[model samples]
Target: MKTNYQREITKHIETNQLSYLFIMILFIVGLIFGAMIVVSMHFTQKQDLLFYLNQYFSRIDQQEILNHFDLFKSALFSHLQYLIIFLLLGLSIIGLPIIWVTIFIKGTFIGFSVGFFVYQYGFSGLLFISAAILPQNLIVIPVYLFAATIAMIFSGQLLKKLSGRRFIRFTVEPVSQYLIVFVVLFGFCLLAALIEGYLIGYYLPLVRQLIN
Candidate 1:
């Protein structure tokens, strides 16, 4: 009887595996699509950053702008932190659409930033983004996707519970898993930021100068 029960449980898990896999795949696909949208927005908002920079240069001294780079980077880091936290919390409360919108917004920002670079330097702008943006995104996107997947799964389980599914054991594991993933995600984000600040910020400018 025990062996039969074990076999049945294993079979159930196996049957449901595809659904979980599909959710994960959707998360990844959503991320890539979000990135592409952001890249597009970058192109659309091409002159925005340069215009702001130009105005700053006109008003402020050149040395001031250079000196403020660290401040600017710090502000960006803070914003990213807030955005991550907000999105994670929001995902837990709201439905998947809310999470999707959050991701889309991120993608739009990436697109706008990339577009701005392209506007400033043409193809060379791509290199700037590759150095600065790619490194952090490599860490961040997967984390977001995983969080989104977990949230969606949790929501689905909640729905199942609501729909009179007595056999389903809806518990705290999903939330706990989400918290663990969130911590890991933030750690990766911190590492990515460090790489961006140290490696990309320090070396990429030199590379650009060399290429130019």
Candidate 2:
């Protein structure tokens, strides 16, 4: 009996998977926008960082270099925070369009940022993006996906319960499932942010210079 119940719940979850798919589709759409931005910016913003590098190297000053690094790190972290919060709020809402718009906007920002780099450095820009952006995304994308899934399930459960529909008791199971997924998503966000801030922020500059 317990096994059968669990099977039913799993089936329900699977059936509702389309909610998650919608969000993912939005995310890919956003990524396309972001990539375009990166490509556009690459052409417009390409400057031989050599001059800037020479200027900084000539000064041979640790404090100024560290300051610039701090500024870049802060900017990166701020962007990450903004993206996470925007997506979280969007997913928490009860409408499909709201979620879709939010995901597209997020993807646009990402696409533009990456596209800017690609336009500037070509394949090297791609490398920079993979190093700088990909690490955090590994965690963030899945987190948002789970959040969207939970939000969808929660909304469905609420509707069914309120409608005085049959099988109202089944709503509790989905609610519990939503809560669990939310917790996991939150945890992944934290881990992703740390990796972005410390590993990528601290090390990427050195890596870039070394390669150059």
**Regions of candidate 1 where Cα sits further than 4 Å from its true position:** 1-49, 55-93, 165-170, 204-212
Off by over 4 Å in 2: 1-13, 37-95, 160-176, 210-212
The C-alpha RMSD of each candidate to the native structure, in angstroms, is: 6.8, 5.8
Q: lDDT tens string, model 1, 41-136?
A: 554454675577556544333233333357447735864664465445534534656655555555556656665566556777787677657876
- Please provide, for model 2 over 1-212, each residue's C-alpha lDDT reduced to its tens digit, 9 standing for 90 to 100: 56986997688768877877777788888989777654454432445543564575444333344443464466456545644554445334354455567668877877776766566567886887788678888777676666655555555546556677465454366546555655656666667766765677566555465324
lDDT of 2: 0.62
Best by lDDT: 2
Instruction: Return the top candidate by TM-score.
Output: 2
Q: In angstroms, give how far residue 115 of model 1 lies from its true place.
A: 3.0
User: How close to the true structure is residue 136 of candidate 1, measured as C-alpha lDDT?
Assistant: 66
How far does residue 161 in candidate 2 sit from its true spot (Å)? Answer: 4.1
